[model samples]
Target: MTEFDLIVFGGGTGNRVASAAAEAGMETALIEKGPIGGLCLNRGCNPSKMLIQHATVANRVREASRFGIDASIDDVHFRGFVREVNDELAAVADRKAQDKRDQVNLTLFQEEARFVDDRTIELVESGETHTGEEVVVASGSTPVVPDSIDGIDEVDFLTSADALRLETSPERLVVLGGGYIAAELGYYFDAFGTDVALIDRNETLLHREDADVARAFTEVAEERHDVYTGHSATAVDESNGEFVVTAETEEGGSVEVTGDELLVVLGRRPNTDGVGLDATNIETDDRGFVATDDRLRTSVDGVWAMGDVAGNAMFKHTGDYEGEIVVDNVVHDAGREVDFTALPHAVFTEPQVAAVGRTEAELDKSGTEYVVGRAAFTDTAMSRALKLDRGFVKVLCDLESRAVVGCHVFGHEASILVHEAVPAVRYGLTVDDLANTLLHAHPALSKLVQKACADAVDAADRTTE
Candidate 1:
């Protein structure tokens, strides 16, 4: 049996913790199965965003005439683009491996790790056992393919991972999810001239988002794709080289969605299977996510878990933040805690969406006294300048603190624009604080943020009696 000061399982963002431990002069060993950068770099976030950016450019040029400028996309080498991204990711993975090689205090085990005991991990291939003074389970998540659906063995279907590597866009694609993944990838392929159809069990797309935002996005999305909401896909069948999904809606009717390919992106499950958690006391939740406290601790001693496995927030940025928290607690022996007050997320589909803090639905559910301020781009000065006909920004304020408790945006570059609202919610900035301190430039997208803040202020001061 071999040993180290620290042992980290999972290669993705877990590498961050390994780096921190190594820098602290601790002998760190990182156990990974082949790729180094985890899901975000390899398949999930970075590569998907890159592909979506190309689709955005392509669609923008195709619709440039709306801005009174004539432009068009004649041809797109979709396969080559995917190949280029994969190649770049390969180079990135190589660089990460080289960095690991350069580190003298860290050992990289390019193999799968399973828990042998609370403190010991055994490699799957060589049966090599290794123990650590401190063990960190950073193994992330994997896309879920449920067994409830029928005809899985008969036909070939694509998961989000498979869809990301597709070289050619099919003539028609049927997507089986309504979350951010479905919205983003569906938009990407649809922009590339694929006839995309979206089927969701929920009545609205992006069910996790604010209801108003979800409805608005669904309304706009329907204009481009065949949208079937309140539809549960019961059976999937393949015939004549096409996939036909039979979905039963709550209104007592069955609808068939046909496409050359089926993309299933229902949700993700934590990668805890076969890792031998039974040998240890690492308690998992009902949904199989590792349980962690505010300081990213497990029930067992000398063992910690973070990232998607911890289920704090699924985004890679959140994983990195969690890694820092673990680094502070483990490497530096500091009792730092995680504060996810104003964590932000985005869906880069058309009529893009970005949100931070609580939704209005959440506030109402909790009986929080709050006022909402909303501004549509169509009603703004910059809308006409940029030829934007859709999108809005909504802000929620707590009555007592007058602080911006939540901010949601649905418009152009909402992801970038949402950062402006992040600080307001994160630092507990009041509407008056924003209005009194910040001045937005004229004829810019940021003006909408300014208007939203101002509106929140006015709405808050009104007498309800």
Candidate 2:
């Protein structure tokens, strides 16, 4: 038994927590069963975004005629492009993992860790065990493949992780689900000249986002791809080396679609079970997510959990914040709690969608008094000059405090533009504060933010008068 001050399970965000402990002169050990950077750096966001960037460039070249440019795409060379991006990102994650292993007074266990008791975990490597104290579980999540669909197992299927590593592009690809992953990959394949058919149970794509934004997104995608909504996939089968998907329509009609491959982006399940939590005092919710308090502490004493396993917001940024909160409580003796208010999220589609804080629908459901102001990118000078007029920014403000309650954007660089409003909403900055600030460089995308704030203030003043 080699006891330590902290032993973190899962190397993704757990590495951050372990570093904090070791930096505080506490003995820390990190146990990982997979790559060091976890899903975000290894398979999820980083690699996906890298491929998306390549697709973006390819798209620009393909449509260069619209801009009066004679640029032509001789060859997509998707395999080589994907290989370069994944290989480069994997190298970076590996280097960071190694640096953490060497820089701190922490031992790295390249094996699975199971909780043996409330305050101890047994690191298992090839059926051998090593003991530790003060354990932290951050073992992330995996793509969920539902077992109800008939013949789903007959044909070869790909999840986002496996799809990212694909060297060959299928001639016809069928994507199930309308979430961010499906939308992104669907768009990428369509841009790469692969015939894509997107099937979803819901009537619109991106059901989690604002309805108008979802409609706009689906409209753009439909222009170049096949979209089937309000239909349920009843079964999937293979016919002569092709996948045949049978879907029952909302009106009780049957529809059959066929493709070369199927990509299931339905959802993800937390990777909490089978880690020997049943043998310890750690409690998991009915959904199999690890239960944690406001301080991110598990039911078991001296044991904490974060990231996908913690079961709050499943974003990487949220996981990073949780890591910091756990450090504050465990090391600095601070009772600092994690506040999820004003958390930002984005979907990197053609017309990007970025959102922070509350939505109008949420406010309406809660019967809260709030006002919304919207400005279209089409109305902006920069958007006109660039011929990019696909989305808008809508701001929600509290009626009493006149402070920014929420901000949602759908358009070019929405992900980058949304960050400016994050601090404003997090700190409860008033619309007047934003209106008075001198934003730099006219005819820029950021001017849209400034103008939106000014318009919000103007509307508020009119209502008062």
Candidate 3:
């Protein structure tokens, strides 16, 4: 038996927590079954974004003639682009993983770890039992391939994970689901000159966003691909090397959609079952997510869980925050609670959508009195000069306190622009504070954020008068 002060299962963000513990002079060990950087760095966010950037640049060149620039793209060369991006991202993740392994005085086990008892885990590689004074589980989630649809097992399909490693572009692609993954990949394939058909059960895509924002994105999506909303996929079958997707709409009409390949992006399920949780006293929710309190502590003593496995927010940024919270509580003995309020998220679509804090519907449901300020990018001098049209920024603020309650943006570089408002909302900065703040560079996209804030203050004043 190998005894340590702490042992963390799953490398992802758990690597950070284990490193923090080891730096504090605690004996620690990290166990990872897959690549050390986990899904986000290796397969999910980093690689996907790199591929999307290629498509974006290609699209820009294709439309360069609109700006009186005669730029012609000879070929997309998608396979070459994907290979380069994947290789670069994998190298970075590998280096970071190795650095963590080298710096910390911790044992790195490249094998599956199963909980043997309340405070012990068995590393399957050496069949060694390691007991820790404290344990942290950060095992992440995997894509969910629903069992309800028939013939899906026989048909050739791709998940976001597989799509990232595609060697050749499909002549026609069918994507199922309305989430960010589906939208992004569908857009990517379409921009690469593939015929894309996107199907979702919801009435509008990105249903979690504001209605107006969702509508604007859907319009952009429809321009390049066939978008079928309010339709549920009933079955998927293969015919002569092609996939046939049968869907029934809310109106009770049957529609058949076919393509060279199908990519399902329904959702992800937490990787919690059969990993020895049943052998221990660890508690899990009905959906198999490890149950944890605000402090990221599991039900059992001397054990904690974070990231996708803990069933908090599933985003990569959320996982990073959870890792920090766990480290603070375990190391510094700080009992800081997790605050999800004003947490930010962005969807990397054509017209990128970024949001922080509450939505109009959420505020209305809570009966919070608020005022809204909105400004269109099309109204800006920069937008006119660049001939970029589509999307706007809307700011919501509390009427009484004048504090910014929420900020939502959809348009060029919206993801980057939303970072400016994060501090304002997080620190309860009032609309007056934003309006009076100095904004540099008149032609920059940031001016739109400033304009939106000023417009919001002006709207509040009119309502009061």
Top model by lDDT, which number?
1
Candidate 3: lDDT over CA atoms?
0.87
Give per-residue CA lDDT, model 3, range 1-465, as digits (tens).
989998888888888888899899889988888888898988798988888888888888988999999998887788888899888887887886787778757888878878888888898878999998989989899988888888878777898999999979889999989888998888788778889998999988888887777888888888888999888898999888889999888789888999988999998988888578888888999888999998988999889999999988889999999988999998788998998877889988778999898888888999998898888989988888878878799899888888898989999888988887888899999888887888557778887777788888988888778
TM-score of candidate 3 on Cα atoms, chains taken together:
0.95
Q: In angstroms, give how far residue 203 of model 3 lies from its true place.
A: 1.0
Question: Over the full model, what C-alpha lDDT does candidate 1 score relative to the true structure?
Answer: 0.89
Per-residue lDDT of candidate 2, residues 160-267 (tens digit): 998888887889998888889998898778778789998899988887777667777888878877889887788999878788888888789888988988899999
Candidate 2 vs 3: which has more lDDT? 3
The collision pairs in model 3 are none
- 2 against 3, candidate with superior TM-score: 3
Worst 10 residues of 2 by lDDT: 124-133
lDDT of 2 at 413: 92
Off by over 4 Å in 3: none
Residue by residue across 204-270, what tens digits does model 1's lDDT show?
A: 9998899889999999889989999999888899988999999898888999899999999999989
Q: What lDDT score belongs to each candidate, Candidate 1 first?
A: 0.89, 0.84, 0.87
- Name the 10 consecutive residues with the lowest summed lDDT in model 1: 434-443
Separately for all candidates shown, the number of backbone clashes (residues 3 or more apart, or on different chains) is: 1, 0, 0
Displacement of the residue 388 alpha carbon in candidate 1, Å: 0.6
TM-score of 1: 0.97
